[model samples]
Target: MPRQLLTDELWEKLKIIMLKMGIYDKPCLRKTVEGIFYRLRVGCPWRDLPTAFGNWNAVYKRFNDWSRKEKLMGIFNALVVDPDLEWEFIDGSIVKAHQHNSGAACEQETAIGKSVAGNTSKIHMAVDACGLPIHFSVTGGEVHDCKEAPKLVAELPKGDYIVADRGYDSEALRLQIKDKGAVPVIPRKKNSTRGNDEMDWCLYKYRHLVENVFARLKHFRAIATRYDKLKRNFEGSIALACGLLWLPM
Candidate 1:
């Protein structure tokens, strides 16, 4: 059997959330969840799940059911902290989609899109000052970072400052962030006719923290490369990874 990803300490945290969410009544909840993580960690097809975790079909069905019902995201949110509202950083990353993971029925609504990388998807996210993710949205890779900035900032739990790279430099976005009562720390574009946005260079240095969060999350194979055909499944994968990041803290 393969090594388990759900250690006893981690299981203690996960089990409580799952139980509260009514994940399943069966006794082997640990194995089932570990099975799901195994697929995410290794980026393998569900049918390849090791027998020690249980039948692959049953494990896949349980995950599918949860993903469809948005229970996985619920589990992630249940364990997340009430994020610090002082400073927030936002950014986006593109992941190449595996061809095998494409072509599902109703897949048109998925975040997959044609980009320079061929088939790809994007994970747009925001992180608190501590560099922990507070909210995220997945979109087609071809979508520009500026296009998604509004949605991410709009959903943020009221913060004092919002930071991002030049990719997010836009007058409208800055005004939107200001409307939320948060100062926008995004840099101004060189050629733009608009005057300076009065950025705080010192605080903007922390924008890399959000990038760091994405880097850690991509260490989980499922997130580094898009292996799921459905958008919700990919969302669930990200949620699980994010929740685990909080489980130990």
Candidate 2:
């Protein structure tokens, strides 16, 4: 059997939220859920799931049903606690798309895009002051972090301050964040004459928290690599990982 991911206490909490979200727990739901976690953490093909977890196809089919119906993301959303609003951080990271992730005949869409890095996808994420993920979006790996900042921050629960690295330094993005009533603490570009304007070096140092958040999420092999051809499947995988993160907090 694969090692456990969620503790009994955590499972209890998750079970309640899932019930409230319409996933009515089944007799074997816990085992079924753990099967998904095993695959996500091990980054194994669905067909390779251990026999102790029951038929791999059933688990895979259940995962697909939930992912296709948005139920997985729904469970993740329902599990989130009210996040701290003191400081918010945003950043992006690229994951190489495994060659096996390709070749769907009916492939209608993909977050994957070609770049010097080859096939890849980008994960744009926002974390609260405590390094808990608040929200995230997936885009083509080649997409610039600055270009996606405005959209990622637009709907976030308002925070007193928004902090990011130089990759997000843009006058337009700064103004957009300001208009939302959150002070922007982005560093200026090297070429820019304006130095540290409204920049809080003290709070900026904590920006590593968001990076730490990514590090933790990426510990789950499924999130560290892009093996799912469909964008929704990748997203649902991320959502499940995020939901588990919230459980421990």
In the range 1-249, model 2's lDDT, one tens digit per residue, is 668788899889888887776776788888988999999998999888998788999998888878888888888777668899889999999998999899855755678898789999999999998899889999999999998888999968899999999999899998998898989999998898988766789999998998898898899898899888888889989999988888877
lDDT tens per residue, model 1, 20-118:
888766877788888999998999888888999999998998898898989989998888777787999899999999988867897346889999999
lDDT, candidate 1, at 35: 93
165 Cα displacement, candidate 1 (Å):
0.8
Error of 2 at 12 (Å): 1.5
Off by over 4 Å in 2: 105-107
User: How many backbone collisions does model 2 have?
Assistant: 0
lDDT per prediction? 0.88, 0.88
